[model samples]
Target: MKKIGLIVNPIAGMGGSVGLKGTDGGIYKKALKLGAKTVTPKRTKELLSYIKNRNEINLVVAPGKMGEAYVREFNIAFKLIGQVPEETSAEDTRRIIGEMLNGGIELLVFVGGDGTARDVYDAVGSKIPVVAVPSGVKVFSSVFAVSARAAAEIVDAFIEGTNLTEEEVLDIDENAFRDNRLASKLYGYLMVPNVKKLLQAGKEASSMGKSSVDSKGEIARYIVENMDKETLCLLGPGTTLKAITDDMGLPKTLLGVDAVYNNRLVGKDLNEKGILRLLKKYKSKKIIVTPIGGNGFIFGRGSKQFTPEVIRLVGRGNIIIVGAYGKVSKLDCLRVDTGDFEIDKLLSGHIKVIVGKKEEMVMEVRC
Candidate 1:
């Protein structure tokens, strides 16, 4: 049987819903104080449950909440690799992974976001292929699978013998991210099963070229012209959405959710609680969003503040997606992974995206 290693970063995504962009460094403590809950447990369980070839492999997992807690629920046989304290850190992730490698694991399946990906790269490098489950806040790295179910599929493909390819691991600055700036750099690469359809494309920065800028302007103009003055508009992050706020001469949090009413900036850098409060205050509400350039994710990637609760309140009919033609034309389809299977299913299907002035494209939203 193929020996696969599993590692989970227990506190990886605690900061997303609370408006802290990432959980790196000491931000997880802040997330806890703000009532953030553990996100990786559900994600880890989902990945384990979806692996169709569970009987074909022997599992090696980290101790406690890191890995063993979830694997024990499944019928699969697995051994504990390393011990961890109540409060786990990045060092624990890297150290345990090293032990798993030394124990002769054929492949590693890690559940976390970009920070956890970097830890995996540091521990294994190109030594063993991995299936990265997207459970963290800033999962902008290309090394991750599109979703938990997709990660399971990648594992099955690896067991059945698929070619391996190197995917980039992005290093994002959490401090800068919380301050309304996206500072990211290519940190390293990890070898993954070359399941192109199941893997997510890495996040691409917005283009500043003349044509791209003009297209964004066109989209922004159309949205601003059609906006309802009586409706409370919740604007998601990205330059395209920023253009809409720019058109009205209102300030926007470049990487956080904001609220607008009557073309006024009512709220800036709103968290889940803040968003819910605004949703309650305003009767007529709508959400305006732009997909990540390469991954084509309208939610569940960068803007986690638009939690499932917020989305349900806004409803599907009130959501407006906008993208520039230069970017939208290349994407196969849009995607969403809100961590709630029900919400994801509710968002899947065909949707309209405003590409330019009076121009719209019908794109399918895949969960």
Candidate 2:
């Protein structure tokens, strides 16, 4: 049997919607206390659902929520690799990867974000190529495939003898990130089955220079001038959208969803349920979101608070996308992986994104 290693970070993205930034260290407990749910199992199952040649491979997985729980739900049989603790850690990821490599697993598949990528690199280096499923709050690494289905495609190509190439393993300190500071570093690289548009580029930090700031100012001016007084505006996180509130002289959360009405900040740092509650109170609503710098993700990266139900309530036409020219130009296309196929479809296609003052461009939205 063709042996493949599968590992899942059970609490990878739990901190995102809860506005905790990441589940690294004891923050996972805080995320749980905030009612954050497991994200990787669902993503893992989505990746598994895309595999048509499952019978051709034997998966080696970690125990419990790490890997076995989702794998067990499927018909495919897998080998259990390690003993998992009730509370898993980065060391568990490192240890499980070592076990997977020692067992002669050909391809390594992990469901996680940047921190998980760092663990995989630390464990095995470039010994085996990896296919990463994007499932964390900080998916700023190039090692991951663009989406769950794309990861399955990469793995299938690997089994078919496709050539592997190096992809960057990038990560940031979660503690630093939660403090409103970005400190990204290149940990190493991972070999991956490379296919065009299948892999994502490493997250690029937005330019803090005058030119980028000027462009954001222009875009912010345009949005504020076009705002309707009767509409309740839900603003997603990022420096770009924060610029809007900055120009309006309103308080804005730099990393969490906030609400505005009548040119004033109404709600701050809202969760999914909090957003839903506002939607119920307001009859006219709109969602203003900006794309992640390098990934071009308008949803499913940091702003999981804009859940599918929230998007549906806001309606597709009511959603506004904004991006700086420097940021949007680096991306191949905009992406949205809302974890709901129907909702993704609702968001897919050409989207008009505001780039500057009275400047908009139509960009393709890929799922």
Candidate 3:
């Protein structure tokens, strides 16, 4: 049997819905204080359900909430590897990985965001391929699959002898990010299954050329001009969407979702509960978002504040996607990983994307 290493970061993604941006450092306590919940368990469960060759694989997992708890529920043949403390740390991750590697795990599949990837990279480097399931607040790393289900597809391909490629392990300093500055750097590389369309590309920094700026302004103009007075607008994160707020002279959170109504900022850095409250107050609403450059993700990338519930409440017709011409041209299609299979299916189709003030194009969105 092909041996596989499975590890879960129990606290991954806890800060997303609470507007903490990430759970790194002492921010995890702040996230819990804001009523953040565990998302990694549910995410890992979804990924394991899609494994078709479970009989051919032996999963070596860590103890308790780290790995064995979820693996046991799935009935997949797994061996418990190591003990985990009540509160886990990066040291635990590295130690568990070392044990798994010594046990001859062929491929290591982990569930977390950029931080977990860095830990895995430090332990294994490119010695064995890895499949990362996105369960953290900011999954800017290319080492992760676009979604949990996609991670399963990549694992199946790995068992089928698919070729592997070295993908960059990149992460940002969350402290700098929370301070309204982006400081992304390449940490290392990991060998990953080269499954086209199943894996996501690394996030690219926004190009600040004059034309890019001009295009954002045009797109912003179009959205503002077409705004319905009675509707509440949920502006997602990214500089492209920030342009709209800039044109309206409204303050915006660079990495959190904001709410606008009648060309005014209603709420900034809202959480899931905050959004639902706003949705209840406004009968008419729309969500305006821009794709993450090089990744083509309009939703389910870094902004988990626009949860599946928020998307369903707004409805698909009320969703407006905008992107700069340069960014849109570089992408094959847009992607979404909302963790809701039904919702994902509902969103999979050709949709209209506004690229400029008067320029709109039809593009396909894959789940």
**Candidate 1 global Cα RMSD:** 0.9
User: What are the models' TM-scores?
Assistant: 0.98, 0.96, 0.98
Q: Compared with the true structure, what per-residue lDDT tens digits does model 1 show for residues 167-195?
A: 99999887888888888999999999999
- Expressed as tens digits, the lDDT of each residue in 216-292 for candidate 3 is 99998888888897899999898988999998999889888999998778898899989999999999999999889
The CA lDDT at 224 in model 2 is 94
Task: Choose 2 or 3, whichever is better by lDDT.
Answer: 3
Candidate 3 vs. truth: CA RMSD?
1.1
Ranking by lDDT: 1, 3, 2
Indicate which candidate wins on TM-score.
Answer: 1
TM-score winner between candidates 1 and 2: 1
Q: For model 2, how does the per-residue alpha-carbon lDDT over 1-367 read when each residue is reduced to its tens digit?
A: 5799999999998888777778888888988988989888889999998987788899999999999989987877799998989999999999999989999999989999888889999997989888999999888888888889999998888877788899999869887777766788989989998785798877778898999999999999999999998899999988999999999999888778999999888899888878988999999999999998878889887788888889999999999999888888777789988877789999999999999887788899999
Ranking by TM-score: 1, 3, 2
Lowest lDDT 10-mer window, candidate 1? 173-182
- Candidate with the larger TM-score of 2 and 3: 3
Spell out the clash pairs found in candidate 3: none
Q: Which stretches of model 1 miss by more than 4 angstroms?
A: none
* Model 3 poorest 10 in a row by lDDT: 174-183
